[model samples]
Target: MNEMQKPVIGFTCGDLNGIGLELILKTLGDHRLLEICTPVVFASNKSINFYRKSLPDINFNYASGKDFSRLNPKQVNIYPCWEEEVAITPGQLNETGGKYALISLKEAAQALKAGHIHGLVTAPIHKKNIQSADFNYSGHTPYLKDLFGVNDVVMFMVAENMRIGLVTEHVTVADVSKHITKESIISKLKIMHSSLQKDFGIDKPKIAVLGLNPHAGDEGLIGSEEENIIKPAIKEAKHNMLVFGPYSADAFFARGQYERFDAVLAMYHDQGLIPFKSLAIGEGVNFTAGLNAVRTSPDHGTAFDIAGKGKADHSSFMAATFECIEIIRLRFGYAEMRQNPLRKMSARILANAVDEKIEETE
Candidate 1:
């Protein structure tokens, strides 16, 4: 693709002390990545040079710019967000690292809103250190929700063919049950359904909803959430799309049931993440669905323990970059298809008839 045709992907330097820059440098170092997208790193030249000096094996060369007007497709571009002198202590957590991380994120978010960049790939951030008077959100999903003026979003994680979404993210286990209401379940299902069709390019997506309790509450023996809230929400959601089961989380993955569905919705964070991480491991990417703009991040965290060791794997970060680009392209195609309402309606009706016939036979 040419310079203008290629998507300009913006990267946020998450916690300077963490492996955020390391992953970015390592992924972009391959040179072949530039052919797919024009990368703009939202950090100062000083930070880039610091990492380059430390890891002399990697090549870090890019054009320095504050905007996307002159993005070089052949070379990575450094968008100067913070130019002040800062200490570089890799693998240590501090307030200064979080401060710079937010600065980079804010700059890139602004550019994203102004239509300068097509998509955003955020590195992991230290949630506690990043919190300040100006930014007080839990993580990137909520932060981007408020930034884009969206009411709800889904924290969808992808690793190859396995796609898992959480109904309640980053909340305590005690609060998770309270948040798993019928409305919330339905809302998340809607987001997941739309994301599958528009972002992942699935025509008719099948989603499995996991229950809040063990054995899916054993059909109300252990907990009433499956019978009361989850089932009701799934019933209502089926009218719009194909949704099935408040399935037992353990057997769902253990028996390879996740392979049968396009996506799976877990009631809480760990329920979805534990299995996904176990299966996908170094290749998972977290995609924030239901946003006007495409935003993705590595599935793992800041990795403060392995920050400076040069041992942090870049596979997940690379997957996030590829996901962002693919989602951007898919969204374009989805928009074009949506422009014709008659065609969409015809397809929907035909699909429903086929589903009805299959149900009758079964």
Candidate 2:
């Protein structure tokens, strides 16, 4: 039997003033999670402790030092990005919170880049506050894309009921049409198709594409994107994948049509997220698909409304953390699956050669 491989997962403190660390602490409090993977959190010790006091129920015995050479496998490990004390004012959105959140994220990302960690599970970061000269993207999807030097990636929302991939995310509603093209649709479809196979372990996945307009453009009366751009793209993808429909978004979800397929590809953000978040009901995970590494985050954002009330639900955060470990395992299994085909092909060739030799001798 093969030995168990517990992946080293890196967790990033998204916003110092938000519930990011609160969720992380609650999830890591359970000793059962430590057996599956070693966690490395990128945040200051002061920042972690500040939240720990409020969450009296949680118990996370951790260690930190100048380096990660001698990490304890059974406890949470903190790699402090800032040595000096940080002023963490919970339930407030300020420049200090954004600055330190960026610091933690960059540190965690660098560790992930250098192969120090196997996967990343990020806490929620406020988009507007986390913007600057160095980080001016709409979300982590684009930032990681540019950082990893990847050409394209998909913002895939995963849940127990359905999985949704967006063609255009964080784009203005008015400009959503300008971004919709046959090529872009096909590209997102390809990424989603591969992710379902490798990341989610779905073989021969059936993907459904949603329309861009109401009533699916009423056959081009309301909008022409569905007929002109989306339909042709689905047809092109059908040559290689099991892709179907520029279905009307409203009626599709209203009648539970998403259950008929493995995944649904939405033209824009709300088209997909509205149904996904409603159905996920606090258990959704936002996975950045098509990157070289694995990353997942809670579908919900920094709930500034309920930041430090001790009322924050950690289910989505826990789901994201557990999903990160699962995807890492699935990816290894997928790599082994790819190698098996070659071995089988080689054996078949050898068998055919032996049969030819026997025939010649007879």
Candidate 3:
């Protein structure tokens, strides 16, 4: 037995208007979820119960703050962020919901640092709906980073067995080039590398880097970025990593070459995410790597239109939960090999076939 103690994971309800609340409620309805790890939701109990009653065939016997210690994995536990008097309407955005969402996130981050919880899995939050009274940071990642005063944070989405990390995020398309400097790429790469090795338990992980230009700047004809920017950064970063490319973005994903590397470092958000979402939409898990504490969320955003429709899919939420466990295991030093079990077997099979081919030639 691994004897690895089950970790307590914190959940943040993102935007009340979005399906974040609905998905959180649905994902917890699975009674078997408790057996894997203890889940603590940081949201209002009123919102939670209202959603449960509104949806049919959904049952969550959520434990409140006073009843936290008595919590068992077979049931759900919720840490109330505000009183029940607060009125909440499905598909409505308000300052109250924004305040509550930020409160939950702050509390969860605190609990993680205090060792009260092992990791965190946040529900989707609306960036625009949130008001200044609750938060001043750009996004959850930035807020958490500032709260912890820790640098080196990266966001990656996992789905279809592909992990993609971004060099720039949450900015206009025009600003992407200016942000793609050697320092920026190097910093993001460092974060990605450490996350894969320490938080993801990938020893000597191979990273695939993409070019900023089309067809990798077509040898400097189409764009100068490949020669002046990306290539030089890769050259410097290579001394500390087994990194490859400045590969053409168009063909790298199409040829399935990305699977060869532990992670693909894309120069911009769309550069990496277009292919990722295309392959893993609705099932992709968004992971915030290189944080002091583990945090993940569904790859998609809050679906305000589908908030109370009972139509939101919980697949991405489930993946985020499972990915949290994997990260927990990695941090605890339980992942023994660089390749996960499935990947190790595949590597062995490929090596054996190659040996047989060589023998035949001899």
Candidate 4:
């Protein structure tokens, strides 16, 4: 396919001090990806060359410019988020890194919002240093939620073995209970259902819900939230979806019960992530569900410990990019399928054909 034929994917370099740029360079350095989609790095050429020195084997070639209209289809492109060079101290978590990281993100977000980019794949960003009066979210999901003016979005973790969505993410344990409600649970279930069908192309997805308390509140002896809150939510969601749970988080994974369901919903962050990251290992990708725009990220934070050492793994970042491109394709296909004029007539046409065949056989 030609450059105009492939999807335009934008990458945000998260926390310049971390391994964000490293992963971007390593992942984009491959020549094969150019055939699938045109890759745009939302960082300056200087930053690219900074990390390029370490990985001497990987050929780093790209077109550098702020204009997305003239994007090179055959080679990587840079947005040059900043003109002046910024100090990049590897393994350091400081505002200096956060400053530039946020700039790249904002620029990329603007392009995405304006429809210049089809999808966004963000690297890891530090929650603390990146915080300001304007950006006050815990992470990307919440940040994008506010940017796009969505009421809520799901922090969905995807892997071959399991898919998990958090009811409450980046919330303190003390405040987790306050965040989850019957309505919230039902809302998350809807997002997962739609995402499975549209993003992953799994129709009629089966979802399992995990409880906030141990042993799923142990039949109300341990807690009442499961009985009073989660169960009711599940019951209501069952009206239109195949959802089951309020399962004990421990037994659910230990017994491999999640394998039966297409997706799993946990009451909070660690309840789902601990097992997902451990199981998915290095191949996991984080997908934001229930959003108008497609966004994905590596299922990892800034590896401050291994920053600039050329030791950071790019598998998850690569997976995120691939997932972003795929979702764009899936969403486009789903939209076309929904809007196809023949769709409404096809069901009746099939029924008549079946009836005619039955009559002929008889």
By lDDT, the best candidate is: 1
* TM-score, cand. 1: 0.93
Please give, for residues 1-362, the per-residue lDDT of candidate 4 as tens digits: 22247989999999999999999989999989999998899988888888899889888899988777899999999999888978889999999888888999999998888889989999999999999876788888888888888777899999888899999999999999998899999999999999987898665678889988998898899979999999999999989988887889898888888777789999989989999977664489999998888899998899999999999999999999998998888887667667776953563465456431111100
- Number of colliding residue pairs in each model: 0, 0, 1, 0
Best by TM-score: 1
Error in Å for residue 219 of model 4: 1.4
lDDT of 3 by residue, 125-201 (tens): 77876757657765777777777778767877777577899888787888888888888888888988888777765
TM-score of each: 0.93, 0.92, 0.88, 0.93
Worst 10 residues of 4 by lDDT: 353-362
Q: Give the clash total for candidate 1.
A: 0
What lDDT tens digits, residue by residue, belong to model 2 across residues 231-345?
Answer: 9999999898788888889988998888878899999999999999887544899999989899999988888888877788999999999999999998887777677998546
**Which order, best to worst by lDDT?**
1, 2, 4, 3
Off by over 4 Å in 2: 1-3, 342-362
Q: Write the per-residue lDDT of candidate 1 for residues 270-327, one digit (tens) a residue.
A: 9999999887645899999999899999988999999877888999899999999999
Question: What are the per-model C-alpha RMSD values against the true structure?
Answer: 2.8, 7.7, 5.0, 5.7
Candidates' C-alpha lDDT: 0.89, 0.88, 0.78, 0.87
Compared with the true structure, model 4 gives a TM-score of: 0.93
Mark the 10 consecutive residues where model 2 has the least summed lDDT: 353-362
